[model samples]
Target: MSAPSHTTSYYAASANDKNLRPALQGQVEADICVIGAGYTGLSTALHLAESGFKVVVLEATRIGFGASGRNGGQIVHSYSRDIDFIEKHYGDKAGAEMGKMAFEGGKIIRRFVDQYNIQCDLKDGGIFAACNGKQMRELESKKALWETHGHNNLELLSDTDIQKYVGTTRYKGALLDKSGGHFHPLNLVLGEAAALESLGGVIYEDSPVTRVEEGAKAKVHTENGSVSANFVVVAGNAYLGGLIPKLQAKTMPCGTQVITTEPLSEAQQKALLPNGQCVEDCNYLLDYFRLSGDGRLIYGGGVTYGAREPDKIESLIVPKMLKTFPELKGVKIDYAWTGNFLLTLMRLPQFGRVSNNIYYAQGYSGHGVTCSHLAGKVLSDAIQGQAERYDVFAGLPQYPFPGGRTFRIPYTAMGAWYYTLRDKLGI
Candidate 1:
């Protein structure tokens, strides 16, 4: 079957640029060959290209076809697991390093937007809405914890004060992170691919890798062609399937749905997100929403284990959106879509090597937006012999699901249910 097109999405409808990269049909060679054209692959290819390396990226589908194109577009800091958890599980030194680097992903994003002049409707300030007192206390602790890592651009908003940002009575409080924000995610990845091409990086869309031969030089076999490179970076993340058995065992694909309401009137937009900041509620199963450049309210929530998309994306999302903004009940939904995010057993990202020359980074566990970009930089650094920072993640322990691939869904779903129950009980 031919590779699919970009999924029907608000991002696809509003994307400013599109490119049809030819499929790889013959043997090609590069200093580095990257599998997957999402954020991690594109970022790694871009960084390598900027450093004057011969880089080639292979994408099974269109650019940003996965979560990169389908996400809520929120630029949140840190990994799927918080730094506090890292401090507890790892150590204070590792925790501090993780915290220091947590905010760097947002910085990398801002730098790319400014340097390349990528027009992705970049916005500043993101709010973490607390739905209850317990969440509020967590936000308070988060503020102090982040401050310890030199992140001082945080403000705690009381229940009434949160109304100045989000037009919702659902939150008890909020944490405003000036350093975090949102943008057009699909355009950001597309722009990064363009930047990579301008630096002489090659991209092959519709090229699916079938196998990888590892050694001093890695051979990546695609359907109709192959790429031989001094190093290989496997970055397919959630959609990788079983290309690598060990990786597939270590992660599960979790699907989430999103919907875009028809462009709201200026008044409606103002009344919704008055200060124009994106808001994500504090829930184990959270809801995130923000305004589009053209004024659509892009709201997303709900996770389906085992990669089963909800029967009705809108049915699953619209009600949740209404719960937060009942005023939008009369508005029609213009678009709805679903995308899978990779979830690791440990919640922390899995970064390690298959061989000395074959490196893979996956399991962002729904925190790929920023961390994927950070992963790209880290992979590039590791390839270029600057392995200090790379070791921070590569050295962390990554374990496969307890029941392996077959039963990980039920195991994880049960765990998520427990947390969801806790969120509901305000525990």
Candidate 2:
């Protein structure tokens, strides 16, 4: 089947400014060559350019054409996996270090927004809503964990308090993190792309890296051109194919779908979410939604491992929205689409060197909105010979799917079905 088109998301339709960059041509040489033009690749290019390194970035399509452009745009400061999972797998100290590293993702994103004056309609509040007693207990435990870590500004809310912000009683309780927020993810990436250009960095769109030859210097090949550089960074999340075989074994592509409703009037918007905070339910198969700056309801959920398209994505997600806000039964959905995300077995970001000079990062689960920015900075730092922060993530353990490349899709689908069943049973 042909790949799904970029979603007619509120972000894509209402982007503040859109520019089409030219594709690659002829041979080129740079100090560093980065693949993928999403958040991770653009962020790395911008930082490296600022640090006085000659940089070139190659993208398979336009910038933000992948999940970076199509996501629900929630810029939360945590990973999709829980903190307890980290503590249990690693030691307490290692868990804390990972927690701190993940938390810093939010800081880096906010700082970039402020420093660059990117107008992405950023909002500064978010809630993790609980649909059942078990989920509420989990939220409370997470609240306590944050407090124990001296991270203030995290408030525990009863169902009543949650109703004030979310305008729904479907949830039993919530954990409100003031630092967690949402923004226009596409705008964030485009602004970073512009910043990189301003610093003399080169970017070539529609130039998919077909092959990577590893050695003291790496050679990346495209149809019309090639880039030979001292260092090569692979930042393509799910769209990257066969560029690096070993890295592909360590990750599986998972599909996620999203839909957006037409703009509601001011009063209708107020009735939907009075506080304008992004909200998501607590379930293994989660539902996340938030109002766009233009008053559209941007709701995203549903994960599938198969490449086959869903018969109806908007229909699948609209009922989930109605379950949260029954008042909007007649609301019109303007757009719906799906994107792929790279998921690792451990559900952590995977970072490692393919060879001496070829570094790669992927498998951010569903948290790439902010984590990609953090990954870019760390990867850039590693290319510059400072590997402390990069090592923190690279040192983490990763396991390839049991069946390797050929069976990854089937195994991931089976695992997803099990999780979906557990979610349905409220386990």
For residues 293-318, what per-residue lDDT tens digits would candidate 1 score against the true structure? 99999999889863333348888888
RMSD of each: 1.2, 2.1
lDDT for each candidate structure: 0.90, 0.84
Candidate 1's C-alpha runs over 4 A off are 306-311
**TM-score, prediction 2:** 0.95
Q: Superposing every Cα of model 1 onto the true structure, what RMSD results?
A: 1.2
Which numbered prediction scores highest in lDDT against the true structure?
1
Candidate 2 lDDT over 88-148, as tens digits, reads 9877876787777767777777887898888888999889998888888998898887766
Candidate 1 has an lDDT of: 0.90
lDDT of 2 at 21: 78
Lowest lDDT sum, 10 consecutive residues, model 1, at 305-314
Superposed by TM-score, candidate 2 places the C-alpha of residue 290 at a distance from the truth, in angstroms, of 0.5
Clashes of each: 0, 0
